[model samples]
Target chain A: MEPDVLLSVRDLRIAFDGVEAVRGVSFDVRPREVLAVVGESGAGKSLTARALLGMVPAGATTGGTIRPDLSDRRGRRIALVPQDALSALSPVHPVGDQLAAAVRSVARVSRKEARARAVAALERVGIPDAARKARAYPHEYSGGMRQRAVIAMATVNEPDIVVADEPTTALDEEHRDQVLRVLGERREAVGAALVLVTHDMDVVREHADRMLVMYAGRLTELGPADEVLARPRAPYTAGLLASLPEHAPRRRRLPALPGTPPAPGALPPGCAFAPRCSLAADACHATEPEPQQVAGRLVACHRWADTPDLLQEAYRASS
Target chain B: MPLLDVRDLVVRYGTVTAVDRVSFSLEAGETLALNGPSGCGKSSTALAVLQLRRPDGGEVHFEGQELTSLTDRELRPLRPRMQPVFQDPYGSLNPRHRIRDAVAEPLRVQGRRPTPGEVAELLDRVGLDPSYGDRRPHELSGGQCQRAGIARALASGPRLLVLDEPVSALDPSVRAGVLNLLADLQDDLGLGYLFICHDRAVVRHFADRVVEMREGRVISGWRRP
Candidate 1:
């Protein structure tokens, strides 16, 4: 791992009842970088984020090393901005009290000092009247306000890395933008690297510096966000981009991925995506492709070079 | 004639006005998407048009018949002309009822006894296996439950379908499939759609025309560019 890498996950595997949900996933997050893990549901994006914090689900066995370089932290240097803020927060307590507890956990601070820090953190996330708002319970806050509070709580101690799982999935367009803005601003303020797990490609395109595409519990593509979006090296990545309705011309049917994601531990033999891939050939069916260095990125595909022009043309026509 | 029409619709709860002077019309085989943020009165507009909630003011017309003026007894006969599919299929569908009975209930409400084959065909039309009719809502996935909901909605042979974020609860891949199914249904049956959604990308693809709402008012309406 590079010296600047804040988090390095290697060969991570999660399984339930002998069924592998996240199989052999690996990635790195550099300091101050926003690494987006994009995939449709059941692709194990959420599980990978959980494994980063050692919070796997019940009945799941995990295998792999998630190395977070947080030597400076006295307690936990990693924080999580969960997808559902309401569930993550204490419903009965005022948000300020909950936030102060988070601060107290990381440092030897007094109750007064922690409360002040909590208000400041809320303000940092763009919540107005932070002191008064902090006194409000989770339900008193709007969806956007609750998410902001969650971001504030997660980053209150200035953690080195923040893992956000589908943070904007519940909000409307306006509120979603607000949450994303606050998340970006807070990350910049704390200089913390972010591991964003989301299925919304538009969010990844807009906020991510690096993109990691997971499919069937494995990494299919990892590269600079722009490069990956411009020309996906993996068929799964290409198919995901094509399926976006934003990429379709008005009145034109979207190019949809024909089938659902394979069930966990029930993936077909050989390439997991070969069954749905349009570029599948004889070689693709016989063996699972390993991640190989191609076009300055890591791509898992045997026939990646053959379909670049086709993807480019399709993207151009739609845009 | 337009399949559904609303003019100067207003809905208020207590001191707060939920929808303010929202107006739109849907022709047969057309889709009009109500796009906006949450708390923008999208649901209120739909409810007022359906007579599920009485509007504070406005006119709701269905094929030249005034729906706003109709009482529960008067509107009972016309209920089959407009049906709703809500966002959460699980919540919208009865948990204890078998899928077959759920689909057949709408037809039964309209004084028609549906055969087993008819219920099976309804399920099949929504892209579900006919055999799924025997199972309950919990036995199915979110997508499957949504398909069953759509199947039930169609059992009434409604000319207008009011879908309130119907595919929002499903995964992205499954969402696309359900969306495609909806489009296919509209095309084949010439059904008009009033699609309420927060997803702009979906609205762009699925709606023939789009109306943007904010602060309980229609801000803009135009043909898709």
Candidate 2:
């Protein structure tokens, strides 16, 4: 791994009961880079984030190397802001105490010391009246404020890498914009690697520096955010971008991919996405394609392995 | 004439003006989305449409009939024409009841009970396995529970369904499936939907007509965007 690479995940395979939920997914999150992971529900996007945090729940198992160059088993160097604030924060405890707990966990400071640090973290995330709001419980705060508290916990220790999983899922437009801006600012201010996992295509378009498209349980494409989205190299990536409602003005119809994802336990032969990909040929069902660089983009499709212009043509036609 | 019509609607919750002078009309088979931030009174207006909470002023008409003039006993039988799909699936479904019984409640409540064959058909129609009727609400995921809720709401064969952030709790990827299902149901049944949500992206995709609200008032008149 390069010295600048803050977190390098190689061949991450998360499985449960002999079924692979995330199969050999590999990517590098560079310092000061906001890497957005965009995919559908069963795409194993959240599982990849959970692997990095070392919090894969029961009945789910994770293997392969998640290189943590930032810290050892010492625990305070990584933090996450999950999608649902109600589930992430403590219901009974004051929001200040929860933020302080994060500080204590990472810094091993006194309760008094952690409380002071918590207020600073709140202020950094643009929380108004940081001191007063710190004492409020999670339920007392609105959806936007609860998200801010989550960001504070992630920043209290001042970690080098922060993971946010669908951070704006349940928030209003104003709140969603606030949370996205906070992540963008926090990543620049602290020089931390921000990995945002969401299915919201707009978030990836507006906030990410790089985009990684996952279909089923594998990474199908990765490159510069706008380049990958504008001219997606993989059919699955193209399908997802086409389905998004933002580009509806340019297209007459929102092109929806037919059928659902196969059960994770027994995937289709060859490319996992072959069943749904329109460009899939006979070879896609017989051989698993490896990630290859095509026209300055990383893609995992056999048909486009030789020519990226074909992907561009197909993407435009579909939209 | 419109299938559902509301004019100069106002609702009060003890000095709090929940909905102020809101006006709209929903034609049969057209989807209307009422979108706004929290406490903007979208839900209040929806509940008032069903007469769940009596409005302070204005008129609500369905198929040339005024709903405000109906009494409790008179309204009970008319409820089958409009149904609500609430936010939380787990909370909406009765935890103690089986799936079959829960869905059948709406049918039974209206003095019409479906046979076991019909109940099995309803479950399968909503994409659930017919065998799933015996399972309890706790046995299903949030998405599955919501499908059961949709089945229950559809049991009475309502012409209009009011959804309050129906898929908020589901994963975004799963959310698309539900949205598609709703769209498909509208086509097959020729039903209208009052879809209330705050996601502009969703409104852009699913809504036939978009109405934006702010500060307990109709900020914009109903129109197809």
DockQ of each: 0.60, 0.28
DockQ versus reference, model 2 = 0.28
Native-to-model Cα distance after best TM-score fit, residue B75 in candidate 1, in Å: 1.1
Candidate 2 residues A1-319, lDDT tens each? 4358878899898888978989888988888899999877778999898778887868887777988644353236777888777887889999888888877765667889989998988887778998999988888887777877887777678777788888877666776777677667766787777899987777888888898888778888989998887777787777666555555442134455655566687689999888877778899999888888886878889987433443344456646
**Model 2 TM:** 0.84
> How would you class the docking of model 1?
medium
lDDT for every model? 0.86, 0.81
lDDT of 1: 0.86
lDDT of 1 by residue, B1-225 (tens): 788889999999999999999999889999999999888899899989889999999999998899888889999988898999999999998999999999999998888999999998999899888999989999888888999999999998899999999988877767877888898898899999999999988998889888899989999999854
Index of the highest-DockQ prediction = 1
lDDT of 1 by residue, A1-319 (tens): 4368777889999999988898898788888788999887788999998777777888999888878634345225887889888898999999999989988887899999999999998998879999999999999998878888888888788877788998888777666776677667755776677889988878888989999998889899999998998888888888778667777766565566776778886788889999888899998889989899999999989989875554566667867
- Which residue pairs in model 1 clash with each other? none
Name the top lDDT candidate.
1
